[model samples]
Target chain A: MSHGDTIPLHPSSQSDIDEIENLINASVHQSVPSARPPSPPRASIPVSVSAPSPSPFVPSNLPKSSSSAVPPPPPPPTGFGPAPNTLTEPVWDTVKRDLSRIVSNLKLVVFPNPYREDPGKALRDWDLWGPFFFIVFLGLTLSWSASVKKSEVFAVAFALLAAGAVILTLNVLLLGGHIIFFQSLSLLGYCLFPLDVGALICMLKDNVIVKVVVVCVTLAWSSWAAYPFMSSAVNPRRKALALYPVFLMYVSVGFLIIAID
Target chain B: MDPNQPEVENYANPKTCFFHVLFKASALAFYILSALFIDNFVIIFVVTVLLAALDFWVVKNVSGRILVGLRWWNEINDLGESVWKFECLDHESLARMNKKDSWLFWWTLYITAVAWIVLAIFSLIRLQADYLLVVGVCLTLSIANIVGFTKCKKDAKKQIQQFASQTIASRFSSTLQSAFSVV
Candidate 1:
């Protein structure tokens, strides 16, 4: 028989009608069970799993009422969001954010709080590109200030990169290679901020007094930016030890800028 | 919805779009051209200063507010202590912020600073110390904008934290009132 013709809509007799009515009433009773017995064990599993998960931070003593009258608790406040990273973000955004971080680092505004698990944010925040770019830029500028020829300009640029690499290597050896290579490079790179500023000031006037003041001020500023970062990177007991090398590193950078001519 | 979540409002702001490109282009062009070819200290100084001033104005008033939906200012209180005030666009507005505008504004800002530094070096090489003053002015302006904007961002985070606590308090009281009335 065809599908539609296979089933009968009406009950054939009074007994059939009574059986159907009883089946309908039984389902209604099962659904509205507050006035009846508890739900069967098999039926309760899905219901429990479907509930919204409560926060682990919430205290156990708090009311657990899931009734309509009780409102849910608000979400907890979060600290700063993750830094912009290279993978998901557009190239321009990542570059811009990194540049901003350099400025912030120079101003002693914020440090790049990198999580080991998220390489994207870490790499974006501490990318070596920034240091390299600024190094070249500053190298070119400093070379110009010193009246260096085009041939010697290359040497100055290479020297800046070499100095950065030396510090990166020293940091890695000191930390037992526990840190990312780029992180070390970034730290070294940002430390160059003061030297970069001092380089400009030195170019401003040929006076010995101004040069002394600029070098001194920049040394202090770069140290201020690098010390906290170095201290945090190493063990508390060895904080001073790690910071010592960082100081020498910045000092060397300052001396290099001063000796550029 | 969590009350702590930033409330964002998005709408058409042509002023934001206009000033973002205008200020960035003008500032950059002026910086590069003035240092490279102008040579005359007076012309270079006036152009650089005027452009820097325009950039400061545009960033503080227009691009900062419209593009990123953040604005900030420092005011001296009655006791003469400086107080920083920061305002951020609601969540909707921030969500709708054009990525292009923000990228342009920031990149130009940093580039301008770098350019000025390069110019200072060029001036020194040319044995002209006077141009250093112009370079210094431009540097201060760009650095100020960078610091102000970043500080504003930090303040917004604090505001979010405060909003979250307030929401929790209000929610707890509302639930308590309902629970007691039910008895």
Candidate 2:
């Protein structure tokens, strides 16, 4: 009886609500309804005793799982377990490698194409961490610089960068050109680093002429960084149609940076 | 069909589409008839342009988006670059727009422009230089919307077409991949 009382404890904790209701139905399966509460611990008690006599033997699972738990988890951990343990490299090594990859990708994207190779081919591995940082940073700076509507500014700047990257990619694609989606997104986000710099500088400089000149240079820089990738992606005939929006989005960010201050 | 739930019927909502047509018609009517009633050009200009501007704002910002699932704007930067901005709802939402609404929105747009152009010609034949300026301003506003929306519609349709082709291509490629695997 003591063993029967404890039997319901483990399974009641682990089993889902459906199983508990099923156990209740079994306990109350008789025509005469009992006044007992429909809790799991009490409900499962009747299931085990009648389990041996009746074919509706759900308590059979209860004892089997308990015994299974008593046995040490399969000895396969020693044989194949080494693989799982060894699968994970030292944590520091992973962090270092991912960090380096992000940096190099940022470099490849933000800087002018250094090699004569195709930008698409060279960017075999891409991480959105750099883009995410740049966008959030731009949003934060734009929000920080705003005299009013701070949260709204952050939201608009963030959404513009995120959606603009996708729309620009789609624009190029619809114009009948090939480009990888995330890589283009990464490139666009990295391009924001220039505007990110422009925003930061605008935040520091109090003068309007200084802000305007900084925004102009940075806007041109961003457009320049993105120009090769975008222009190359579309057919030469409709290249302006595709590139104009990219220029416009960057110009918008620049304007936001100037306007917010 | 439940009379309480009129939207369940297999038809487009007429109420909103009627208003869409009404706004454009009223704007045109007021601009033309204002010259007859009001002797003052400034009052006519203010009222006529006000109506035209109101229609432009409604069609550009409100009706275009709601009725046809498209919007457009042109922003000229300080550097003198004319940047055309466009917005179009995804294919699903565009499909969900009322057929009558789309029809009414577009027909009214073109017909209104034609009406204004006819007015412009009448002003030209009469050689009423002052009224011609009003027509020109109103004509320019209406045509700007037409061009913007036309380009936006083209972009949206092309996007949906591209999406369809890509989906078919992807499914075809997947089928090929599975066939090779089975082999």
Candidate 3:
């Protein structure tokens, strides 16, 4: 149909158009003449129907046989067919086919890389390596600081252990059990050998206000570390898992710092 | 929504608030620690104030500006790909604008990196180890910021390219479908 003629049909009564469409669909199916002969007969009907209509609904420039020239027949006053049900199986089947094909192709295209499908492994790597690296560096720093000042070596070592524990705990909360446990164990040597770092530091420092401040600071940092995982970018379950290690790390650091100071 | 529009306000993410509170608390704790351990009150006060100011600037300004730059980059890149479909600006003009903006972003990153390195080195030289440790923690917080900006840039580039690729692919498929139906 000509685009101009189709414009007028849009505002026509919805039920009337639907009834007309149903009638046309039924007629087409009922009178399914052999494909070779039916085309010309179907093409001729519009030419005969449009000859008398001079209304605005008809486009003058359309080919004489095209449907654009014919005014659609008025629909019956009452509803003719069953109310439209929820989408039928055939409609859903087509949608499912399209979606499955798209998803399959996308998966194939996106998942060829080594890390693409193994996010858990990636999280484990980050959790383990991040704390491992941080602890080793912290140990070296503490060793050097201890060498310079003999009395504070135990205190520094304890602080590092607490930092490691807190980091491990937060990673667990963020990454989940597998990563958290791996990270915590990997860093456990530091925490255990550091001379009861949290308690030692708490004994050395006598002030209550400093201990309270340290606790508050640690809580705040833990909350910060956990915040990004809570974003829409990360999966909810993963975010929850990641926060555990963050919480542990924060508390551990707070306690150790409070003890040392 | 037009991603091209400049970010008028900092879209405060949960991370932003968390970092703000963390940094503020860290700063306060460090100041108190320094007051207790180190005898130089004036120097500690000045450094603490400066750190606080820096943290505030980061929490307020950095992420939003980076996001704005990223959005502009994507819109310009998209415009370049669909230059023929748009009538207002020709391809050459759009390409020039894209080049200019992209360079601006790179320059900003370069400057920020240089400043961070210099500050880190200076802190190591001048500040006490405890004070430097607090700075280290603050600096490490930028790991998140860097990751976020990198991800934004990467995603923006991917999205723009994907949109162009999808449009071309859909058009090709539609044409093939019509041609096959005719046959």
Clashes of each: 7, 0, 24
- The DockQ ranking, best first, is 3, 1, 2
Q: In terms of TM-score, which candidate is stronger, 1 or 2?
A: 2
Task: Report how far residue B22 has shifted in candidate 2, in Å.
Answer: 59
TM-scores for candidates 1 onward, in order = 0.37, 0.40, 0.32
* DockQ of structure 2: 0.01
Off by over 4 Å in 3: A1-162, A165-167, A170-176, A179-261, B1-109, B123-128
lDDT tens digits, residue span A81-150, model 1: 2222122233345347546766654443133343334322232234444455456556655666766363
- What TM-score does each prediction get for chain A alone? 0.51, 0.65, 0.27
Tens-place lDDT digits, model 3, residues A1-261: 222333223253444344334444444334322311222211111101111233221112211111112334222112312222111113345346435644443332223233344323222212222333334344433333332442245334535554656665555545433333432343332222222233333444567885565456435633443333222224566665555544565465555445433
**Which one is best on lDDT?**
2
Assess the local accuracy of residue B8 in candidate 1 as a C-alpha lDDT between 0 and 100.
Answer: 43
Candidate 3 chain A minimal-lDDT segment of 10 residues: A41-50
| Candidate 2 local lDDT, residue A247 | 95
lDDT of 3 by residue, B1-183 (tens): 234432442332345344444555555566657767876533453455456545544432332232222211111111112110101111111121232233333334334334445556766887556545544544554433444445543443333333334333443454555558669
Lowest-lDDT window of 10 residues in candidate 1 chain A?
A42-51
**2 against 3, candidate with superior DockQ:** 3
